[model samples]
Target chain A: MKILSTLILLVALALGSAQAQKFITKSGNIRFFSSTPIEDILAHNRQVNSALDQQTGDFVFRVLMKSFQFEKALMQEHFNENYVESDKFPNATFTGKVTNIKDIDFAKNGVYNAIVEGDLTIKGVTKKISEKGTFEVKDGKVIGKSTFNVLVEDYGIKIPGAVAKNIAKSIQIDVDVNLEKLE
Target chain B: MKKKWLIIIGGLAAAGIVLALLVYFFVYNKPHKDYSKAKPDFEVEAIAFFEEFRTNAAASSARYNGKVIAITGQLSSVEVTDEQVVALFEIDEGMFGSEGVRCVLIPEKAETLISIPPGSTITIKGHCTGYNETDVILEHCSIAI
Candidate 1:
């Protein structure tokens, strides 16, 4: 009976440690900027959902396209109605892995550079992407941040000739998320 | 006679320019919708609303996305910050995490939000941003009195 109890305690400890390997944030922030000579457009979405698995190096982000708020209502309308078509494709997701997760020590309080490779889906189109970001481990929280440029045309978003000058061909995307331990 | 015609044309040109400026200001520089004052398109209980999404996400999203909705439920949790207050309504426990209606309240309601204890029933009105496979996001939320 003693040996059996010891085995059960060990199994419970293993499960507890496994749970500690996951971190998540439901209120992540994602911003996209499009700059042109005629106009500059920027939108922010604070309802991003992201998760990271320390053991597997798996990272995932889910962004609701409709949650993006723009300064100009017209821009937001056009972005949803004509650009990304939020009615048809309401969410954009990134499912990838941190290639260099081994180098980052989550137990230590410091910022570490990370490379993530994953499939990014936008407007129902999936594209493979590799981006560089930083993970800051502080106060038992992990803050992940990254900025990258995505070509508008790559996602099959066609700009009309009339408003082409108002929008940029490539948009700069910024991601910031503070993830807490699941337990 | 020619001078008179030119004056009329000039006056019309000036009026046209003024009209163009008005259109630009009203259409292009229009402000975002103030959800605090706007009436919700749908008033639903939090559990029913979440179940609709879980049962048929595509149809629920079509009906609710980008629309202002009022949801009443027991507050499961609250995360307060200087910028905003986020309140969660317990929906279900998924493999990844707990799924629910997550409302991001306007910064002005931070004080009121913090005072409310968890498990208290409340109604939140905001713009629904559809389900992210886990939580149905609501932004610019206000406590519906």
Candidate 2:
């Protein structure tokens, strides 16, 4: 009987804490880098928006592909037309949750590393990924950051061998995000 | 000996001239459009604008061509290309509501983007060139500092 009462109290507290975390950020960053011996390409998209459900550890991030710019006009054309098919797949996304919710204390200040497992979708392909990311809580604001790699082929991005050797099979991705506490 | 020295100097000068010309062609002669100068037609919050644009990219692509529009948001991505400069400005944490749309600015307008750090607010002006899903295309855009 005592254990049941304690469980009820814990569930109530969790629900209350989640209700308190209604904040989100309108802008975030997602970057991709593909380096090959023949050419090294780096592209990033800054205009990302995401929301974090503190109670459920649910998050969603998005960006447009056409927004990615390259230095050479030829390269930009190729990126949109050939590589990313910007016209076909205009947006990329990440939807997931933080596994260890009990470890995060949003009211406190300091940096804590959390493992966030989520599904990242790009170019019409989705993959399950677990990322080790940094989370910071300061003055009611939370910031999250992580870096990982994804294979182009996994998403069905095909590169001809002529330049394929130059482009690594897997691309490195970096993410930096910040969110404000909502009332 | 004096004649030979003069000839050598002449050759060196000619080589220097050729090198300078080559550098100019390779470095500075190409297209240098910086679209960050096109005036903005409107100013809208990033999230709300993205939602509206994404809802109608397929229908509006033709109408948006070469149209200038203004957007404010965090700088999400920057890509420098020889044919054109492109930047992706985004805002949204969810796929719904006001968080899915982005402004893709190209060409000369990119020049005004002096520096964009992650998590900073920026307002940009450029022409709309239709839509690819959630991206609102802008041509000849410039930043409104």
**CAPRI-style grade of the A/B interface in model 2:** incorrect
lDDT of 1 by residue, A57-84 (tens): 9999999999898989999999999999
Per-residue lDDT tens digits for candidate 2, residues B19-111, read: 999986676335524456545556677666666666666544434433466777777666553334555665554333333334444444456
Candidate 1 reaches a DockQ of 0.81
**RMSD, each candidate, Å?**
1.6, 10.0
Task: Please provide the root mean square deviation of candidate 2 (C-alpha atoms, Å).
Answer: 10.0
Which candidate number maximizes lDDT? 1
Evaluate model 2: give its TM-score: 0.62
- In model 1, which runs have C-alpha deviations exceeding 4 angstroms? A1-7
| Residue A137 in candidate 2, Cα distance off native in Å | 1.7
